[model samples]
Target: MAKIKEKLGRWLRVAIGGPMGIIAWGISGASAMAIVVWGLQTVALPLLMLKTASWGIWGLGVFRESRAKRENPPPKV
Candidate 1:
């Protein structure tokens, strides 16, 4: 009788605890993912904008240089 009660208690604890543990684990994982995504967006967005602007400026410089060279060709060596 004592052994049966002990087994039943352990089974009840497992039945109650398993789903709760799973739920807690899922919430923690989702929270961690949200934090990581937020951090990446915060840090990456400005950097991406800066890089795009830099590329645009560089492209304009190249275009201007090409146009100038075409207008004033260097004397042939």
Candidate 2:
């Protein structure tokens, strides 16, 4: 269905865009901490791993919360 596809697209955009916006907007906290650690890491290996882990956690939380709100519409009679 077009509506379903649109909804999915919107969700994906949010998932991908959220972090980017956070970074662009200079939002801080855990993600900032991870980024600082990443930038300081001299070796590429652990940096990549931590980067993935941090983004994964961030994305998973945002996607889950977004999906829940999307899937559950308000009650109506």
Candidate 3:
């Protein structure tokens, strides 16, 4: 009687609230992911590529200097 009604009310709340909570969480998570991706694409990726290119150029200079040193060692005593 009363116990059955109370149980039914609780079950109804759970059935309605569960999916609503999941939907809200999913929407918020998707929004955050979109913002992060947009920010990375707009700002971070180009800077990273530029930094990588600079490092590659620096590495090539270092390799050329090392090759020159190996080819012409200092005069032996």
User: Which prediction has the highest TM-score against the true structure?
Assistant: 1
Rank order by TM-score, top first?
A: 1, 3, 2
**Which residue pairs in candidate 1 collide?**
none
Candidate 1 residues lying further than 4 Å off, grouped into runs, are 1-42
TM-score of each: 0.42, 0.39, 0.41
Candidate 2 lowest-lDDT run of ten: 21-30
CA lDDT, every prediction?
Answer: 0.53, 0.58, 0.53
> What TM value does model 2 have?
0.39
Greater-TM-score candidate between 2 and 3: 3
- Stretches > 4 Å off in candidate 2: 1-43, 75-77
RMSD of each: 30.8, 6.9, 28.8
Weakest lDDT window of 10 consecutive positions for candidate 3: 13-22
Compose the digit string of candidate 2's lDDT tens values, residues 4-54: 797687677566545553553343254456657766555356556656765
lDDT of 3 by residue, 1-77 (tens): 97679557655544333444345445445545655878755656555655555445445545554555568654564
